[model samples]
Target: MKISRTIHMTNSGRKHKTNKIKSIYNNMLAEFKRGEIGYSTIAILGQSCLGSIAVILLLMNDMPTMIKMVQLFLVTVFCMAFNGAVLAQLKSKITFDLLIATILLSACVIVTNLV
Candidate 1:
């Protein structure tokens, strides 16, 4: 009986945690869709995601540092294109500051690695 009770509690606890995570994810998605978060925030976050993937790809290829930088730059540009398109679809204007910030960040990454 005690073993069965422990199993049931564990199952319920797992379900509770899963539901909580799902709720949080849904809320965040809703906010992004609603434009509650500004474009810069969204772009940075999107770029970060793409950048991580690019890093993983670069690692797997065992490429040179220069090549890795170039790949990262390309990934950053692709992320910008995607974010721009999404903002455009929502009729949101892309600002110069956001563009410059992302470009500078990408450049910094490449330049720092070159040193």
Candidate 2:
């Protein structure tokens, strides 16, 4: 009788599944660090306006309360991440303060919804 060995491959196989995603995220982070002031400003402002509009629309829509809350949380997280990236790029004191204020306001809204 001869013994044979067979290797089974999983979904990830030999490479980590998240390597591509991790590389992309790292590249984006590096770009943000080396981005210009004007570019960072434009991104921050544009994203702020868009996020605000999205939150407003979600609030006014006929969605369930839980769904609206989840949407709000996701929107707030995106807004904060954008602001953080801009702040990291520009290293501006004003951007830092704005980020803090945005977080506080989001927390207040969430609290109100929960209560």
Candidate 3:
């Protein structure tokens, strides 16, 4: 009975943590959508520059062709999706999410290429 109680407590704790994280994520998305968490022009430019450098590094890396192609495809897709969101005037939250994804994906690619 004690073991079962401990397990139940652990499960409930996990659920609580999950709920907290989800709440935070939802609140942040709402703020972005409402333009409360603004992305300034400079921030956008900086993200773009980082993404471009990452792409350049990826292209110039000596990795296998197949890997390069896959990475390039990922980057292209993320970038295109972000651009599409902007062109279509989608919710700011969606655009912001895509922009963040592009930046994060680029950073990962850049780090992998550098290493």
The most accurate candidate by TM-score is: 3
Among the numbered candidates, top lDDT falls to 3
Predictions in order: lDDT: 0.57, 0.65, 0.76
21-93 in candidate 2: lDDT tens per residue? 7777567556655555765677677667766766776687675899888878977886887677676654544
RMSD of 1: 10.7
Kindly list the per-residue Cα lDDT of model 3 for residues 1-115, writing each as its tens digit: 3445343334644534458777887886776666633443444566678778888999998888998999989987887787677768777777878887988998999899999
lDDT of 1 by residue, 1-115 (tens): 3445343334644534458777775675555556644755766676666456545655566558787767666666755665675566543333433444555555555445444
What is the overall TM-score of model 2 with all chains considered together? 0.48
Tell me the spans in candidate 2 whose CA falls farther than 4 Å from its real position. Answer: 1-35, 90-115
Clashes of 3: 0
Q: What is the lDDT of residue 38 in candidate 3?
A: 48
For model 1, name the residue pairs that clash.
none
lDDT head-to-head 1 vs 3, winner: 3
Model 1, 30: alpha-carbon shift in Å? 1.3
lDDT of 2 at 88: 68
- What residue pairs are clashing in model 2? none
TM-score ranking of the models:
3, 2, 1
TM-score for each candidate, following the candidate numbering: 0.34, 0.48, 0.66
